[model samples]
Every structure is written in C-alpha cells, then in structure tokens.
Target: MIPARTTARTTRTRRGAVVAALLALGLGLSACASDTDTGETETGDESAAASEDETEVSIGIPSGWDEGIAVSHLWTAILEDEGYTVDSQTADVGVIYTGLAGGDFDVTFDVWLPYTHASYLEEYGEEVTDLGHWYDDAKLTIAVNEDSPAQSLEDLAGMADEYGNKLVGIEAGAGLTQITQDEVIPTYGLEGMDYSISSTPAMLAELKGATDAGENVAVTLWRPHWAYDEFPIRDLEDPEGALGDAEEIHVWGTSDFEERYPTLTKLIGAFELDDEQLFSLENMMFNSDEYADEQAAVDAWLEENPTFVDDLKEAAGV
Candidate 1:
C-alpha cells in the first residue's frame, strides 16, 4: 500500500511512449499498403503477357503441295510477327479436310474449289467454311515438252510409245490423279499408255530428266506450277474439259474460324497470288537447295517482295 503511487513525470513519460508506438504502427501499415499496390501492378502486367501468349493458331498443310507449304509458312511468319504462336501440320489433302471438319485443325490454305477438291467439299462442306478464293485460273493439265508434237491430250494416244509409253503423274490421292483416272484417260483414249503414279517431286524429276536429255516426256501438271517456267513444258489444250474446268484455289477453315480469328480471316480473304507471284514464291521455296531451311526461304521471299508484309497487315487492319 505504501509504494503504489506514480509521479506526474512518470505519467507524462508513459503517454509519450504510447504516442511513439502508435506512430510506429501507422508507418508499418502505410509501408504494407505500398507493397500491396506494387504487387498488384506486377501481377496485372504478368496477366497481360500471358493473355497475349494464349492467342494461337494451328494450320494443316497438304504434304505434297508446294503451294500449301508456301502459304502456311508465310502465315506462320506473319502471325508470329504479330505475337501469335503458330503450329503447322503436314498431312494428305484428304486427311487435312477431315481434320478441319473435326476441329482438329484451325485452318488450311490450299483448297481448290468448283472442280479440284470437289469431292472433299462435298464430304466436309457442312462442317467447314470457305474463307475465300485467293487465286483463280487453277486447273489440271497434261503437259509435254515444248518441242513435242502432242498439242493436246487427244493426240497422246497415238504418240504414247514415242514418249516411252508412260504418263508421269503426281500423288495417287491427288484430285488431279483422280480426274485423270476417272475422266481424262477414258475421254482421251489414253488407256493404251501406262500410267505411273508417284509423288510430285518424283514426277518433276522424271520431267526434268527427260527434258534435259532431249527426250519426249508427258506429265500430268497443273497451272500456277513452277515447272512451266523452270522447265520448257507446254500444257496440252483440254478441249473436252475432261480434266475439269478452271478452279479457284481457296483458304478453308473450321466453322468457327472467323469467330476465333476475325482479323486473320480478313487478311487471308484479301490475299491474292497471280500466276507470276505464285510461281516465283514456289520456285524460291521448292526449287532451291536452301529450302530445307523453310523459314530462310520464306524470309528471302519476303525480302524480295518487301511490300507484301505491309499489304497483309494493312488488309488485316492490324
């Protein structure tokens, strides 16, 4: 009882200590708020980058067609430049169409319509969408060496043995081969000639060898092909139209393709490649020793046609 009393000086000191502690606690709370705000800003930045990364595209390309390869790579380059991740798959044309219908692929570049790929469109047209035609004047042709006497497929029957009794053709699954088997051969009386079914490069090799050796050669070819310019070959006149009418090379995609990529759909729809442009681009990619490095080939092409990228971007409204 005797020592329980506190002095005024002691009371003042305790009040001062309590005020100092409150000030320290307030400073700590302010520092915590600042840290939380900085952390939120950093998290938002990371989220934005991840969102950009999530935008992607998957393209299916027909294995034997150089045109498909060319445009697929070109699109991949363009999309990558715009910060999209792109995947390119090489498969047979039939497989590509099926994949598109099943949603396994996002898009494809080389769909020949009205004649070529007619059957594919019939089978999958309901599930897929035709983005647009990029090139017209596409057709199947039977070509001969420039000096050959055969001016048309009608003349090939009698002169079959003169050209080694054989007609060199591309892939067996190709629409061209189908047309030749079902229509062209019977219409032109070409059954007497032995038909050879092989890959495009193999057929091209045969054509080049025969032409280089000064021998007569007959080949199944198509327009917008580089062989016409690279080798001296002339397409036979198709008076009967058995090889089918002129086609439009189109871009095809899944049903939801436009909804998923409105900008890209516009860009692809606006794309145009005439005979000269397609031939040169294909020649650079397919006929060069440097083609194993496809990106390099595409880059070389873009360098040669410098305005193409700007034109595509402008068309896409990017």
Candidate 2:
C-alpha cells in the first residue's frame, strides 16, 4: 500500500509540472503575436505621416510688386503639380534676405544680381547658394513718354529747372533709387536738383498722369517690366553708366537647402525665363482683363504654356 501511495504522489506532481510548462509556452506565443501586430501598425502610421509631410514649401517676395508675385505664384503652382503645397509672403528685399538667412524663407526668384543686390550678396552670398540666372540683360533705366521732347536721360539733366529740379524715383530703399542718389544724379551733375523718391505704385501713377496729359515725365524703368509695355515709353540712354551695365535676375536659396529638399531645389535651379516670356507674364499680370488677381494671371499663363512646364520639370530631373 505504501509503495502504491508513493507512486501516486509522484505521478500527480509530474502532471502538475507538465501543465505549468504548457501554460507558459502558450503565454509566450500570445505575447509575440501581440508585439508583431503593434509593430506593423506603428510602421504603417509613420509612413503615412511622412508622405503627408512632403507636399509643401514656403517662399518670400518683395511687397507691392504684382509682377513678382505672379511669377512666384506660377512657380508655386508648378511645384504643386509635383506634389508640393506652396506658401508665399511679400516683404521688402532686405526683409526677404533676412528671412532667408534665418531659414524662414525657402526661396526667392526675383534677386537682381551683381548690382541691385550687391550689398545683400556681399553679406549673405556665402551663406546662400546661387541656383542660376532666370532673366538676363535686366537693368535700371530712365524712361520718358513717347511724345516727350526729352529723348534721353541726358536730356532730362538740363530740363530740371523747368521740371521743378526733381528726378522722380521709385521706393526710397530700392536699388534703383540708391543708384540714382549715389551715381546717376552725381554723374549727370544734377547735384542741386531735388529728387523725388516715391513708392513704385506712386511713381507709376505719376508717369501715367504725366504721359496722358502729354507732359514731360522721367522715371526709373527696367526691361521685362510691365511699365514698358503698359506705357509707350523709351529708355533714356545712360552715357555716364551710373545705372551700371546689364545684369541678370538670379534664383537663390540657403546653402545646403537644396540637398535637404532635393526635388524642390532642382526645380528651382532649373527655372529660367527669357525676356519675352517674362515680359508676357508681367504684361498679363499688370494689363490683362481676364483676371484681377495676380495668382489667377499666373494660373492662366501656366495653362497656356504647359510645354514650358514640362521643360522645367525635365531640367529639374523630376
């Protein structure tokens, strides 16, 4: 009887041990399944978030230049087509450079280089990388109404006595304005004349009024600008070269930003517009009746010029 009882206890102990081992194995398998499911769900969510984050960038431009705004919007729309959302802001050129240096702005397409923005470039050129020239042979020029007797910039120098001893200029801080103050006026020996540095819109308004009334009006002008098309004006010859030689409009961004956003960078680097294309775009923005909004004008241009868009994309390797 004692031997049988001992054998029975041993058997019961063995059964309990086996049951515990099997229960532990089942729990281990369930934990692994739970971990695998959690990992897969997390990865899927992360991927979706990353994809959503890639569709946008921000740009900066100068204030009140409707033409610049339209061009910027065109580029933004092009980027949108390539899976990017774009935001733009308008400020002074100085502010734009500051913002870009701080990484607040991703790009600027309106930098007139080697002259207009020489100081800015000297200060920040090393910090930023030049993409390429967008428009060429751009410069500050003096223009007069087609009917005016003042045939050239030199003609205006003697007529200052009749014209209130004033040379009408654009915004006070503009590169053209500075050139007029530092070089143009001095070179022309018009030191005693009063200079009127007005805002861009104001200057345009003055020109329109003067031209419509058939009076002599001279103001700063540049190529590829809408003012040239809207008004029948001629660029006054620059004998003294105070306005400097012809320059190119450049595209620029913060250093290494292209590497950070390779696709956007390449697209920006590939951007280039000839005189005709830019002039057309500017004219549409400033003179078109089809659209009142600058951005709408840009959209229309893009719709009409799809081939150019493809070329830009191809150049960008997009």
Candidate 3:
C-alpha cells in the first residue's frame, strides 16, 4: 500500500500544477485573500472591525454551471439580508477547488460527488471541508434535441452524419467534459464525431440556435439544469453507462468553515431543494428574458416562492 505521506505529497504536487495552470489562464489571486498572508493583525480597534468583517464569506462559482450560479447568488442575497457579507467569483472548476483548499475561497455550492469532480476532491479533500449535500439525484448526461432521429448515445456512431458529426460541449476543464473524453468517446465509439469544447454559455447558445431553426444538435448537459425546462431536449439512453451514475450535489468550503460560521453552516447544511423547486428556480434565471441579471432572477423566484427563504431559516433553527 502507498504511504499516506506519499499520497499527500502527490496530491500537493497535482494541486500545485492546477494552481499554476489557473494562473496561466489569467485566473489570478484576486477572488479571496489568503488566510496566512493577509497582512492584518487581530488586535485593538482594527480587531473589532476585523471580527465584524470575518462574517463575510467568499464563494467561488464555476463558470458555465447554472446551478452553482443560481445557488451562489441565492446564498449571497439571503446571507446579506442576514447581515453577513458574501463575495462571489466566477472561475473554472480547477481554480475553484484549488482556491477552496488553499483557503482563498470560503465556499462553493456546486460539487458533484462520487463522479464529476472526483479528481479534484481526491487532490484537495484534506484541506477543504465537505458541508454536506443539498441536492441528491444529480446526473451527468449527453442530451440531444427531442426531435432528433438518434434516440440513444449508441445510435450516434451509425448516424454521425445526420447530426453534423459534432458534439457540443462545455468548458474543457469541466469534469463532465473529462468524462466525455475519457469514457464516453471510447465506450460509444464516438471518436469519429468532432467534439467542440467551449464555455457553457456557448454550448447553450448553439443549442438554442439549432433548436430554433429545427436543426438537430447534441450537447453535454446535466439535470437540475434550466435547459431541460426551457429547451426541447431529451437524454440519450446510455446503455454502456459511460456517463456514470447519478450523484449528489454538495456545498464545500474551507476547513474551518463550520467553526467560523456555525449558524450559517447549520442553515446551509439543512438546506435542500427538490427537483421541482430547483428546476423552477433555474428556469426563472435562465429562461426568462426579462430578468437578465442573476440576482434579479433569484429575486423573481423568491417572490414566487414567497416563504422559501424564511421557511428555510426556520427549518435550520437559525
């Protein structure tokens, strides 16, 4: 068996590489201040101010994931209402996990367990904290237009030319994309199909464009996503199980997150959203053309749900 120290050393090395890549991608150290090098002392008048400011939580939102964006904004709005400041930054998945492990980010709401993001968790699980899952039955999927001729992932290989021989995808660094490249392609013999890896927004834009014009389009997507409610899409049957099984969605944070904000942690831990609620919330945020802003969209949903925030706080005993 490998020694624990060696495994830790290997993780650290991989994490360092992730940090370096993030920096090169222009994801600089601007999201959150490092705990050890903040250059501030906890004493005197400054101490009181620091103590008050310590209630602030830094959250990292992985780009292109609508669920994370929605929940992160929701937390920020509600936390601010509760007199706690919230900072939300958009970053790639690699950068987000790295920041959480290094204490550069206080929390993030979009960790997919046992499958998507498994590699990142393996690397940084020791330094970061798992705050428990908020949503279960989360899934990774390869979706196509509902009217498409191909009904399953297996059918794509034979009729590759019918769908323009392309599979639109999200961020190249995303775990879903990694799985698609490593497992889906090989398992389904889809190496002949051209896979386009771009941002989530780009993939959505392509989907919308194709669907609008009655063109067949295939893209990587996930459940609890607004696209299902907003677009005419259906999940292709995965007989090979190349896409993996359904997993839970977790909220992860810095190691001392619980100790630093016990009440908030409790509230977050008790937080849970069923499929109807989650899908409706995302639909408001993504489907509505009027509420262009994330916060505005969340506010719209809260207005519709009416008692959701207050009810959640009461349930958490906070």
- Candidate 3 lDDT, tens digit per residue, 190-259? 9999999988989999999999999999999998798887789999999989988999999998998877
Which predicted model would earn the best TM-score?
Answer: 3
So what's the TM-score on candidate 3? 0.82
Model 2 worst lDDT run, 10 consecutive residues: 2-11
Candidate 2 lDDT over residue span 149-227, tens digit each: 6665677778776555666787765677788888888788777777787777888898888878777777776666788
* Candidate 3 stretches greater than 4 Å from native: 1-53
Each prediction's TM-score versus the true structure? 0.81, 0.80, 0.82
lDDT of 1 by residue, 6-73 (tens): 11110011123322433443311111222365554333332223233236777887867778778787
Off by over 4 Å in 2: 1-54, 64-67
User: lDDT at 112 for candidate 2?
Assistant: 83
Q: Once superposed on the true structure, which residue ranges of model 1 sit more than 4 Å away at CA?
A: 1-54, 290-292
Comparing 1 and 3 by lDDT, which wins?
A: 3
lDDT of 1: 0.75
Model 3 residue 148 distance off true place after TM-score fit, in angstroms:
1.4
